[model samples]
Target: MIRTLLVGGAGRMGQALGEGLSALSSVDVVGLVDPHEPARLFSAPHFRSLEDVSVAVDAVVDFSRPDSVVLSADWCASHGAGLVVGTTGLSDEQRSRLERAGESVGVILAANFSLGAVLSERFAAMAAPFFDRVEIVELHHDGKVDAPSGTSLVTARAIREARERAGRVTAPEPTERFTLESARGADAGGGVRIHSVRLPGLVAHQEILFGGPGEGLTIRHDSFDRQSFVQGVALALAHVNDQPGFFSGIDHLIG
Candidate 1:
């Protein structure tokens, strides 16, 4: 049985995870650590700090802020607990810190946990060989702080690597100088342009456009709800302890 401790248990993603974990007989909600105490009691004890918990948890799942992930990673390492992190917008330094922590215990980090999104990334990379021009557009809810979603960055990087391995160079830059800096979206790997959209009533979505000589291909993935991520999180929690290192995507768990 997997006994899990969830940090940021009061947040939206945390609540969804709590309910999902509670439904599994093989899993137990060992404890919850949330600074903003939940209004009602949970199936497990709620504590303000990891130090307050007396139980031995098999894993720690964090849906907290980026700033809190490093601390949680350290705590997990010290306690010999597996970690699954879903927080986004971490700086390069923070990511390095998490990687170091993973040396001691299993750690899995993902920006978007939707299974379809993971497949979309793989498909895009595979299609990169036939396409000469490519661009990525990622859309998310307005509340998301990051401009370009982490999923977009990952996809672009994968596509760039695949193209490089195929010995294909990106098309030359179109504009020597731009009247406005924002005229073109951010430049990602291999000069692939990335456009970000933030709007109300949107969950998470991304599209990869590939252009060849006579035809074009577009691959897209849309996450309509947070429930799309629950299964991925559950899978990570169930198997994280088996691997003792840093893992980046759900593709690794997808067989």
Candidate 2:
């Protein structure tokens, strides 16, 4: 069994992971690292910080804030634990830390831990070179703190890379004048425009639109519940230790 420590034990995603993992015989919730210490979903020990935990675990699943990223890699290395990180909106410095940490221990960092989302990104990239212009719209619950969603960023990056491989430049842009400033969504490099929508009823949804003369294509993915993320998380936890480097997407793990 994998002795696992949940870094954001009390958060929504963390709780979901705990509930799902508890049902499986492959993983045991050895410890929880969260400051709030929300209602217990399991009988695991709770620590306000990973630094405070005395128990040793084989792996850590981090779904916490970007700030918590400061110690994640080092914590994993010091504790001899493999790490599966799903935190987004990371700064350049934090990314660098992950790269360094991967050299010492196994690490898998991904924007979204949903299999459907990863497949959607892959399909979008495959279709990118054929389209003249593309736009992405991402919607999430109002409680989400990040804009454009990390999945959208990952999709944009994949599209850009595909275009580069196809010997294509950035997608075409509209020449019309904007009546309102910032009317167009923010350009996320490679001429990909991203629109972020946050409202109460959304539980993670993204649409990618590809346009060419007289034809268009739309690819979309929706995560209706938190459980949509469980399988991917579990898969990452199971395979992380086998690879001793930082992988940026779920594609590499499942593939």
Considering every candidate listed, which one attains the maximal lDDT?
2
Instruction: Assess every candidate by TM-score.
Output: 0.93, 0.95
lDDT of 2 by residue, 1-255 (tens): 889999989998888888888778889988888998757758888899987988869899998988897587888887678999998998999988888889878888988888999999999999999988899999999989988789999899999999989988775666589989778988998989999999998888999999988999999999998888888988898988996888887898768
Error of model 1, residue 231, in angstroms: 1.3
Model 2, residue 11: distance off in Å is 0.9
Q: What total of clashing residue pairs does each candidate reach?
A: 0, 0
In model 2, the runs with Cα more than 4 Å from the true position are 169-171
In model 1, where do residues sit more than 4 Å from their true spots? 39-42
Per residue, candidate 1 scores C-alpha lDDT tens digits across 1-255 of: 888998988877788778877777777888888888864445788989877878989999998989889989999899999999999999999998889888999999998788899899999999998888999999998888887889999999999999999999888877889899877899996969999999999989999999888999999999887778878888898788986899997788998
Error of 2 at 120 (Å): 0.4
Distance from true location, Cα of 240 in model 1, Å: 1.2
